[model samples]
Target: MLDWDDLRIFLAVARAESLSRAGRALKLDAATVGRRIARLEEEMSAKLFVKSPQGYALSEAGDRLLPHAEAAEQAFAGAQEELSGAAGQLTGQLRIGAPDGCANYLLPQVCARISDANPGLEVQIVALPRVFNLSKREADMAITVSRPTAGRLTVQKLTDYHLHLAAHREYLANSAPLTCKADLRGHRMIGYIPDMIFDKELDYFAETEAQVVGLASNSASVQTRMVQSGAGVGIVHDFAIPFAPGVVRVLADEVSLKRAFWLIRHADDRRSERLTRFAEALGQGLRDEVTRLERLAADTTLAGL
Candidate 1:
């Protein structure tokens, strides 16, 4: 008989694209993951993955098994949560996929509170630079900068947040004055790599005339760190600015940008009232947090730092 644990391992390997990454996620060593995958393949008497220099790619057999495996995973998760409920406790895992910016700067506080409230619940944060596919069950919920146009998902505006052109105090003092948008050309700029920009909302340089980015990364947290290190001026979220010493908003009057976060979840999961309540609480907490962030952003004392 096939083992469910092996299927879980297969899912991890498929999602991660590499044995090393799958091992990290599963808390197993690479050799162990490899052995389990080999064992699974032997049991099925078929090739499940195409091992390549690039990484493991799912074979035809693996592709055929994926959806069913995902369904079984979902069913198992639902059963565990429901069974726990019979014992008067809610027990399940909630994976939230978010961009590095939000995941690093904001979700920590929110997730902490959720974990405190539900001691039996396990929370997994999938902080990735790319878009999350809700249809694939990549996340139980997702927080996206823009509302997705199409998906069988429940979407709501979490909150409207702000971003500003910012740089370290030392970088601004030494660089050419950014009295206007035109002055931006004289200084180095850091932002997301143009070709790797996964969403249109993250293209901070779209309206700017920056000839080239001095530093670029797919992760917004990396871009923020580079800017904080006095590398260059970059657009940063208001929530993140106060936490980084010596970082402050620049050209605030001229370059503030408004964006909203959309909360998304698979529509079918709405049947669980616990998740719906948790989502509601999380959304409200996010709104309150953004309000605090906006106040801090507008404060000149902190901005001077």
Candidate 2:
């Protein structure tokens, strides 16, 4: 005899990791969310979450209940969409997890277009420095650089994009000559901290002998910015060049990297037609963006020549 409203609240709180955040999402006050959690725990006769300074962490019972709640939510959404007589009528929030680069440069435009078409849908982008955990329900869908090896998830290759060693024109003009890869050692370089790299696929410097980074950050966007500011040279995505106006590819003949993005979602949610369409839209958007990136890279290369 548990209330569906309570389960909805519980799911929101678990996802947001804070009562205040869940309340804002649900359009309820924080006090109301707290009262509902208290009621839910009383009805279930078990504590659901651990209240802490870092926000709410799900207890063992809450973790066990999460999948059931998500399943129920999906069922309700399917029924609602079917009853409305439009498979395109999606009315729930989809949280997408992705690396900082894609989250900042790609998904905002993509999600905006999707949300415009589906007026009832909300898209939340969770930009993380590391890989997203689909099994933990960290996101409804994720865009990953590396293909997951183990998980009950549906994954698709979105698109392949290129990265190149780049530096600001001003930096190149003002600093040492870089006629060869060996010259990289003498220049101030911006890159990710070696110890903080979360995935092997992101280890762009692995093969290089460069041992020093003048400035380090976990975010590709930040590194791009530093390079744009003429702080140092760094590797940047071809697509991201549009943002860094003065940044230009250097050592193009010697340094070109290719990487791909994979879209992933829970296996059980594959039957959700709305989710499927959204994922497809994401793939198409990325493909279009990759095409643009290729053209840009070609143009830049020609200009440099």
Candidate 3:
């Protein structure tokens, strides 16, 4: 019989792609992790991993075994949750991966509320500029700007948010008057580095003719900060505007863009009651927060008018 303990070690190694890293995560020495993997391979009678300078690469056998292992892991987790009487309250660690904009402006408050309600729950947010790999278990769940077309993943539309051309009041005061998109051509634009835009949804400037990006970063927060510093005009999220006091919408009627945030999870995770509850809470929290922030931005805009 395949040992459940060995399979757990196998999963750690597969995800970390290094014995030492996996060992650290499992709180065991490298030799113990290696022995566990070797034993598991012997029991299965197949080579699960191949060593390369880049680290452990899953062999065909390992690829074939991965889903089964994950399913088993899920089953065990569900059983543990049921036995531990945690069905009424969320506990343990939950990690979420998201683009830095949401991470910086949105999740902090939302997660704080959730954590406060569920005292035993621990939340970790992994903020990055690129897409997360759900299959590799990079996070328990993820928030994304665009729905992924391929993957064994389930996507839930959390909420729709808006963006518009914006600049610091001082920057607008110093620059030439803008009545239309044509005037944007003369202004220094702040935006994502062109080629580094990971998703088409993120190509906020593609729909407009303003081509030159004078200041750019792959991060949304950085782009917003540049605009706050009066560096240049850039497309800024409506929900994020309230956070930057001096940044105000520009050409609001003309250059508005709409986008949606999607919650992504492994399809198999749907069976976990803990995750399902958390997903519901997270979705509602995000919608509420977005609406609240956007309203604040609107009030700020009206006050400026």
Candidate 1 similarity to native, TM-score = 0.75
Q: What lDDT tens digits, residue by residue, belong to model 3 across residues 15-74? A: 999999999989999999999899888989999999999999899999999988988988
Residue 229 shift from truth in candidate 3, angstroms: 0.7
Kindly report which residue stretches of model 1 are placed more than 4 angstroms away from their true locations once superposed.
1-79, 82-90, 300-305
Worst lDDT 10-window in candidate 3: 296-305
Clashing pairs in 2: none
* lDDT on C-alpha atoms for all candidate structures: 0.83, 0.85, 0.89
lDDT of 2 by residue, 1-305 (tens): 87778999999899888999999989999999999999999999999999999999999999999888888888887777678754556667789999999998888888887788888788899999987776556888899999988878898999999888888888888887887777889888888988999878888975454668889999999999999999988888888887788888887778788999999899989887878988988899889977876677655541231
lDDT of 1 by residue, 1-305 (tens): 77889999998888777999999989999999999999999999988999999999899999987776766676776678777754544467788898898899888888887778778977888999888977556888899989988977888899999998888888888887777778889889999888998889998887676677988999889988998899998988999887788888877777778999998987766666657766887898788888887688666322332
Tell me each candidate's RMSD, in Å, in order: 4.7, 3.1, 2.0
The model with the greater lDDT, 1 or 3, is: 3
Candidate whose lDDT is highest: 3
Candidate 1 clashing pairs, residues 3+ apart or interchain: none
Each candidate structure's TM-score, on Cα atoms with residue i matched to residue i, is: 0.75, 0.84, 0.93
Off by over 4 Å in 2: 13-64, 83-89, 135-137, 302-305
Say which candidate scores most in TM-score. 3
In Å, residue 172's CA in model 1 sits off its true spot by 1.6
